[model samples]
Target: MATVRVGEVEVGRVQVGGGVQIAYARVGHGPPLVLVHGAGLDGRMWQPQLAGLADEFTVVAWDEPGAGRSSDLPAGFGLVDFAHCLGAVIEALRLGPAHVSGLSWGGTVALELYRHRPELVRTLILADTYAGWKGSLPPEEVAARAEGAKRMLAVPREKFDPTLPGLFAGDPPAAFVPLLGTMAHDVRPETMGAQLLMMAEADQRDLLPAITVPTLLLWGEFDARSPLSVAHAFQDAIAHTELVVLPGAGHVSNLETPERFNRAVREFCRAHA
Candidate 1:
C-alpha cells in the first residue's frame, strides 16, 4: 500500500467502489468522524480540525480518488459515485453511523452520502458549501472562475502562490502558505479539472429536503465561494439544520480561523455524537 505522510497524519490507501484506492487516515479514538476536503486541496486541509477533534473523536480524513495520496482518477466517477466511494470506506472501516464533515466540494459529497445512504451518517458538518451551485455564479463570475481554475491548473506548482490570497479573504497566517504549497503540488491538473467539472454540473437543491439527519451548516461571513445567502438557503431547506457563520472568515474557515472552527465542531460532536 502506498503512503503519504503529512505531519502526524499518514495518508493510506483503501479500496472503494469501482476498485479505486481511496487514501485515508485515522487518528485519536472515539466515535468516528470523516473529514472531506474541497477541490484542488486534499485531506491534509483538515489539519487543524483533525488535530483538535482527534482528542475526543476518532477523525478519519481522506483524499477523494485522484486527489492527494489517493490513486489516479477512476473512470465514470461523479458526485454520487464519490458518495458511494465514501460509503465503501465507512463499511471497510466498520465506522457506520459516523459523523461526516465536509468543506466546499467536500460538503457536496457529504450531502449526497446522507441523501443516498442516510444510515451511514449520524451527523453532518457541511462547511462553506452549497446544495445548489447552479445559477449561483453569474455569467461573468462563471467565466472568471472557469478561467481562474484553468490558470491555476496550468501553472507550475512553484508559481501558484499568487492565488493564495483569494483562498483567504485577508492576510493568512504564515504557516498556511507552505502547507498550501504542498497541497497544490500534490494535486494533478486533470484531477483539478475533473473536480471543477463536477462542481459545474452539480445541482443538489432537490436533495436538501430529503436530508433528515441532524445537520450543521458552517460558513464564513465573508465567504466568496459560497455566499451567506446561499448558506441561509441551505438552513431553510434541510429538515433539521443549524447555521453558524464564522465572523470575518472566508472559504477555508477551519484553517483561516482554527479556534472558532474547532470549538464549534468539538461542542457539536460532544452534544450530537
Candidate 2:
C-alpha cells in the first residue's frame, strides 16, 4: 500500500499537441487514478475526490483543452482529438496504465479514449454521463440540451452564473454552491462552445458493448441530466459493469455526496488492484 503526503495540491502542465498544453492537478502516490470532469467544468470539479482519496491512489484530475488552465482548442479538433489528448495526459504524467474516471461529457470522453486506445485504460468509472445525448437521451431532450449549450456561449463572462442548484438533489452544503460559482466564473466561453459542439455530435452507443475493461457507473439518485435510466442502459449494454446510486445526490454526486462517492471508488479500485 502507498500513501501521499497530505499537503498542497500539485499542479502541472502537459502539452497535448499544436502548442496547446493541458493542465492537471495531482495528489497522493500509488496507482494512477485520472479524473476527467464534465463539460463547463475544469479539473477543479474533482477537488473533493482529490482531497479525500489522495492517501490511497495517485489521483489526477485534468482540465480539458479549452477548460481550466489548459490551452485553447486548435483547428480541426474533434472528439477523437480529445481522446488523443487524454492519452497524451496519461503519457506526460507517466501514470502507467491508469484507472480512468469521467463524469458527464468526461464519461463520453472516456469512451472515446477506449475507442482510440483500449490498452492504456485499466478500469473505467463513469459518473453522470451519456453515450451522447443522441445515443442515450430522448431526441427532444437532446435538442434541448444542444440549444442550451448554444445559448450558454451567448452569456457574457461578467454574467457567467453557474447553475449550482440543479447539480444537487436537495439543498447542497453551504460550501459546495459557492465552489460551483467560482468554477463557473473560471469557465472560458470560447472553449465552452467547442465542448458544446462536441456534445451535439458525439455518439458512443455502438461502443458500449465493446468495452472490455472493468467498468463502474455512479449515478446520482436524483440526477435529472443523466438519470438512472441512462445507467440502466449502460449496464444493459456493457459487460463486466457495476452500478451504484448515490442517495440524496443529483447530477454531481461525487461533489454532493463526496464521502459515498470516494468510498465507492476506493473499494472498487482496491478490488481491481
Candidate 3:
C-alpha cells in the first residue's frame, strides 16, 4: 500500500482482489465522490475535478485496471469485471453509497455499478459518455469503431497515438496538453483493446429505465463521440435524470470547461446529499 503526494492529494494503491492493485488519488473531506476516467486515460485526467471539488467533497479518482498504476487487464475481463473492481475500491475505502461519476467509457462502468450494486451509488454523474456503442450508436458506427479499435491494437506502442480528433471542439487546452500527451503515451495496447472491444459490444439501454437514483447527464455541446442526441436519449430513458450541456466544449467537457463542469457536479451532489 504505497502512497505519494500529488499536490494536496494523496495518491495511493490498494489491493482490491485477485492480487490486483488499483491506484487512486484522493483529496479533501466530505461526501465521497469517486471519479472513473475514460478509456486510454487514467485518474490523472480528473486532476481538475479533484482539485476543484475537494473543498466540498472527498474526491477520489481511480486509474482503472490496465490503465495507470493499476494492474494489467486479466484474461476474460469484461464490463462486469470493471464494475466489480470499482465496487471493491469503494468498499476498500469504505466509500459506499457514494456519488459515483464517470466519463466516456468510465460512464458505462458507472452504469454497470448501479446495475449490479445499486446500494453502493448515491447519485450518478455521467459525462460525454455512451450507453455503450451498441446501445446508443447506429450499427454502422459501432462496426467502424470496433474496426478502429482492432487497427489501434496492431500499432506498435511507439507509433500509437491516443489523440482522438473529436476530443476537443477546437485545439487541446494548453495546460492539459502535456498531461494528456503523457497519459496517451502510457496507454497500453492490451488495456485499450479490451476496453474498446467491451464498449463496442455493450448495450446498457435495458438498464436505463431501471435506474432509481438521481442521474446528472453532463454533456459537451460539440461532443462528437457521444453527441447531444445520445444525451437526449439518456435523458428520455432514465426516470430521474437532468441534462446539462456545456457550451463550446467537446467530448472531454470537464477538461475543456472545468469551472462549469465543477459547478454542475458540486450543485448536483449537494442537492442530493
Candidate 4:
C-alpha cells in the first residue's frame, strides 16, 4: 500500500477494475466505514468527517473514478460502472461488510452498490441525495436540472464561479468556499458531465423496498437542491430508515455544519454497531 497526505489525511491509491486507480484516505481504526463523496468532489470533501469520527471508527473516503487519482472515465460509463468500481475498491481494501455513507450524488451510487452487491453493504447512511433524478423528483425538474448542467458546461469557467453560493442556504465557512473552488478546479469537465449524465438516467425507486439493512437519511434542513420533500419521499419509501435534518445547513451539510453532522452520523453508526 502506498501513502500520501492531503493535509493531515494520509491517502493511498490502488489500481482497481480495468486498470483504474482509485484514491482514498483513511483514519482511525474499528468497524470499517466507507464514505462516498458527492458529484464534483473528491475524497477530500470528507476531511471534517474523517477528523471527527476517526477516533471511534475506521473512516475511509474515496475519490470516484476520474475524480482524483482514478483513471479516465471510458465511453459508455454509467452508474453500474461506478457501482462495480465501488465494489472493487472495497474488495481491494479488504474491508468486509462495511457501513457505507454517501453524500448527494454519492447517495445514489450507494443505492446502486446495494442493488449490485447486497452482501457488501452493512448499513446505509444517505445524506442529501435523491433516488435518482427519475426516482424522487418530477420529470420537469429533472429536465431543468439536466439542461442547467449542460448550460454550465458550455459556459466559461468565470461564469460558473458566481453560482457556488447557491450550494448553501446560509453563509458557508470562509475557508470552505476557497477549498471548494480548488476542488472544483481539479475535476475534469468530462468527469463532471459523465457524473451528471449518470444521475440524469438513474432509477432506483424499485430497489428502495428491497433494502433490508439499517438506513439513516442525513439532510440539510435548508437544502435547496435536494430539499426536504425528497428526504420525506425516501423515508416513506424505505422500509427501515431514520431521517435527521441538520438545522441551518444546506446541500453540503458535512462541510456546512461539521459538528452536528459528525455527531449525528457517529451516534447512528455506533448505535447499530
Off by over 4 Å in 1: 1-11, 135-140, 147-165
What are the per-residue Cα lDDT tens digits for candidate 3 across 106-216? Answer: 999999999999999999999999999999999999999999989988888888876666899899999999999899889988998899899999999999999989999
lDDT of 2 by residue, 1-273 (tens): 112333567778887568878888888889899999988889988989999999999999988998888888887878898899999889877885889999988999998999998888999999989897789888887787778777777887777554523667777667777877778888777777777667877778999999988999999999988889999999999999999999989998888889999999999999888
- List, residue by residue over 62-81, the lDDT tens digit for candidate 1: 88888887888877778888
Q: How well does each candidate superpose onto the true structure, as a TM-score?
A: 0.90, 0.93, 0.98, 0.94
Error of 3 at 58 (Å): 0.3
All models: lDDT?
0.81, 0.85, 0.93, 0.85
lDDT of 2: 0.85
Alpha-carbon shift of residue 76 in model 2 (angstroms): 3.1
Q: Where is model 2 more than 4 Å wrong at Cα? A: 1-6, 160-165
How does candidate 3 fare on TM-score? 0.98
Model 4 ranges with Cα > 4 A deviation: 4-8, 156-165
TM-score of 4: 0.94
